[model samples]
Target chain A: MIEIVSAERCVACDKCVLACPTNVFDRGPGGVPVVARQEDCQTCYMCEAYCPVDALFVAPHTHPLPAGSPLREEPEVAGAGLLGSYRERIGWGRGRVPGARLAVGPDLDRAGPAPAAGRAPAGPARGARD
Target chain B: MRLDADVLVLGGGPAGAWAALGAAEAGASVVLADKGYLGTSGAAAGGGNNLWYLPPDPGLRAAAIAGRQRLGGLLTDVDWMARVQEETFRQVNRLASWGYPFPRDASGQERRSSLQGPEYMRRMRRRVHRGGVRILDHHPALELLADEAGVVTGAAGLRRQEGFARWEVRAGAVVLATGGCAFLSRAFGLNVDTGDGHLMAAELGAELSGMEFSAVYGASPEFGNHTKGLMMQYATYYDERGRPLGTAGPAGRDLLARRLAAGERVFARLDRAPAALREAMRRSQPNYFLPMEKAGIDVFTQPYPLRLVLEGTVRGTGGLRLSGEDCATTVPGLYAAGDVATRELVTGAASGGGSLNGAWAISSGTWAGAGAARFAGTRGPLPPPGALRPAGRAGMRPGGPGVGRAEVDAFVAAVQERVLPLRHNYFRTAEGLTESLRLLDPLWEQARDRLGAAPGDGRTALRAREAAALAAHARWMYRSALARAESRGVHRREDRPAAGPGLAHRLLVSGLDRVAVRRDPVAPRLLTGAGVP
Candidate 1:
């Protein structure tokens, strides 16, 4: 099963989810993709392949390898962007650059303080970049 | 009441069925409990999962090419994701062939492949029952049974049959495939979804991250666009022409850069008639761009022109933070899966394989269930909470005639009219958000008046569930909207018109009534935004 998108990297775009066919995801609060129907996954890398930002991963089970093909040790399932492959060769970087998972967090100053009840907290910006 | 079983699966959807059968097949007694009739609720309950986003070999080739070019360096391994695709294809095919009557394609192949939750939920019920899993209907897990130190021991709940009856069941481990908080949102007065799993996890002290992010998307037109999760295949946008339109763009690395860099609203622009797009627009009435003809003047011909809606904080990301194969929370003996567990595997709609993919993750529940069983071996029995508490007094309030049903309809209409298509579109601003909030608040206040306790037997339970779901979903929508100050992904803030260079960071908050905020580490690195590296 795929780990939930990190608080920082997930923009809640639902791209990783929309590309799926199984209704594996549902809109959690704040529009984030929630894995509502997970058991239906067939280990097909469709989600990992279609995720613009590699936000998803699909791995085979512990079952033996299929015939002559070697069992994949660590499947790095890739995602396809919304634009078909044709535009890819043309290198259109304008609006076609799909997202990928990132290892980062929110820059505090830009986002302001987290809310308390209905008001913003007065603590130091904790997620700010050093 | 005492119930014994080799396996006790909470949800009756695909995952639950698989968990029960997997264990049952392995020679254990299995009991599956569901809030609704088996397979009648959830995505598969309506029908089978939608089409595979990636069509076999050809689709894979196309996606691979697009991934490299459109996504730049962001795409992950194609082979692995393809494997996932292959698995889902086989599973769905097997289920349909095994008597789950999906709509057939021209070649007689079942083609009901869609992410439509209702459709998919229906199909799962038919097939799973055939697989020999014991199912209990209309039973909701009221609470987890725990030991003196709070270690999870089992579950207690109400079986809504003739009356509100309490029951207890013992299990080694429990998997919470209860879906997400869409229902909860309605309960809390949010425009979007409820935080069901989030609330449940929190009550058990499971650490949650990503509440600040919600992934709102253009609902598939077929599904009336009421539910999200279908924006991955096509990139909807306007051309130089000022009309609504769309294109089958690759998933990554293309026309999105300019907007991402400039912090413009990124959404789909459909090419159909306005009337055809009305239903989708009504439900999510998203923000959109007018496709421009060559020189950016003439409107394109397509009328069902739709665009991605990013008005509020509809990022669907949150859950119990996990460290490894073990999905342990700060609290022991508790386990979660589906949307509630926040595991490390994810993909787009086609990429994610929708409902079919969920079946694949049942192993997590199996593992958790087994682990729970193992823990139970050493732990003493837990004391039942006696009686399930009444729907708390804090949540009880009378419906005031001040906000009538008509007002809610009008409010929904007004929001659809004023907020959507304009401010809620790809290009969002603080001012737009503020304006939208103002417009929505009155209706929300009125909706509150419509909320109250129902009088009756099990009917009240059903009503209460619906009410709670609505309240929870509403709360997230409202609070998330207020929290986000800039445009990102599905959220576009007009006042903060430019994408922050610091796109790598995120916002984290806590507290039920008063949320506390903080930022956790950036999630696993696979896709970097336009600039923020």
Candidate 2:
């Protein structure tokens, strides 16, 4: 899933090794990073962004519902407004219930009061479009 | 750095998090540690869709427990099963309170969107924060520290700071939520799963069962690497000639078996699935959909390639044995929960995802947390550092010798490639397992020497520690596989496909020096069926 274009460019700073949440990359004998476990890539792209050499190429990546943004793109929290979605989901805005729904599933679905009818139909992210 | 807690819970997955929550709620000074940054690690890193809580329907509960008993061979602890089955709703409610998003129908009944995504952990981490429990992110427990009498008083681990700082935790009680072995699985993009807790507990003479049973699953052969699992029920399978190939369950074992026997490249007819089912699946498991879209494989009009995913440790059996009492290990003051703990509650059932295990993580974790907190209440001060030491200093890495990153990687790859997955799993045999060991034992002899770390590389060094843990675990797993000559559920041996009536038992493993398997009989409980009226 991840490929280092040319090993010659790799300075072996080990940033890619450290950046991976899945421990996807292990330092090769020559100090260049290798994708020994590509199947576990998840296409998160953390290794690509973290590689200081800019030698990494992750194959045709898909945007991960933008959970919060760039786990593989930028150095930022991916699930940005995820907490707000949480509050809306359980009928609790800020630790307090907005409506009389008991903060459980059956109760919140019927909802005395709430945010909106739909969220990320695919996931809880605020939007599906960029 | 050194720190102390009344109860220290290892790992930050659902189990450890819930364990910490339960312990903190019980008024213990709890400290939670993880190898990865908490919340964003473990199998639940994405978020969990299936929250297999017990339904209020009485007959369903009886039938569910009975089904598991039939599959798992009556080893299910009904008392523990009853408590966790009922109490897991509290875990679900706690998640809801923290704003975990579970899709509900117009009728407002909760829907199974997907098995864990980032959302589940997002709420869990928030709860951990609110619980006021002390946190140590990026701390992986390497070894358990014991007093003169062999009682566990604390653990020694790496803090994973600059050059990987040495760290120590003095605890009144320790819970091993370190999870199971995933790196050993096929399709190896090696993550943090190297069976640390399994090896660690084994070193201290903990008993492990179900090692013969691996948590193998199926995925789209075309997109298996990039995706988790395609919503199989919504897909149709046809051979290259368009002949019907049998479908797979949540675990995919059935599908794999049929395909293997038929000797055909089966393609899932996702195009035939109704729009509503496809849409529902997409919303439930978005990650599965994103990859399909990216790969240009539309389930609506096209058939997708299917393959067997050998995730040995995912729902794989073989973990620290749980006492019906309090999830404690044979070692006093030490307990295990989550994947690190064997599936005692659902022992006789299929190890499917969703509510079965997701809820198990929360339920077992909750009980262990409270049980540990109570146990901690009676603990005395930790023994002096000098008094607490491993029995063997040089041989303390447990099963083998020293090695470096490359060696460890190669070893893991070998296990994934030759020793495990298709060859050693599902289709099992005494000869196959024995042959696997014949290849693995030499590696074990060389494993420690192979698992080494340079002075400067902390990340590799941490992996080195985990590699040693995995090497030790591999020995135990393979040994048990060879010893258990019968097939049941995931532990299907071709030479012995049918489980012998007498062989419906457990094979306990420890003593890495000799690597012995002690078979224990399945003692069926008569009076304590959870919902069987």
> lDDT winner among the candidates?
2
**TM-scores for all candidates?**
0.51, 0.78
Give one digit per residue, the lDDT tens place, for model 1 in B145-207. Answer: 555565555565556542557666665545555554433211111121223344444445555
lDDT of 1 by residue, A8-37 (tens): 345777755544433356667897677775
Which stretch of 10 consecutive residues in model 1 chain B shows the poorest summed lDDT? Answer: B285-294
The regions of model 2 sitting more than 4 angstroms off are: A1-20, A23-130, B109-116, B184-190, B226-230, B240-244, B250-265, B390-402, B448-450, B526-533
TM-score of decoy 1: 0.51
lDDT at position B480, candidate 2? 79
What's the TM for model 2? 0.78
lDDT of 2 by residue, B138-247 (tens): 68777787777777777877766434787787878888898877654433232556678876776677777666666354354544443243244445577777776554
Please give, for residues A21-124, the per-residue lDDT of candidate 2 as tens digits: 56557688777777765644555433543455455545433222333323233222112322122223323233643321221222212221222233211111
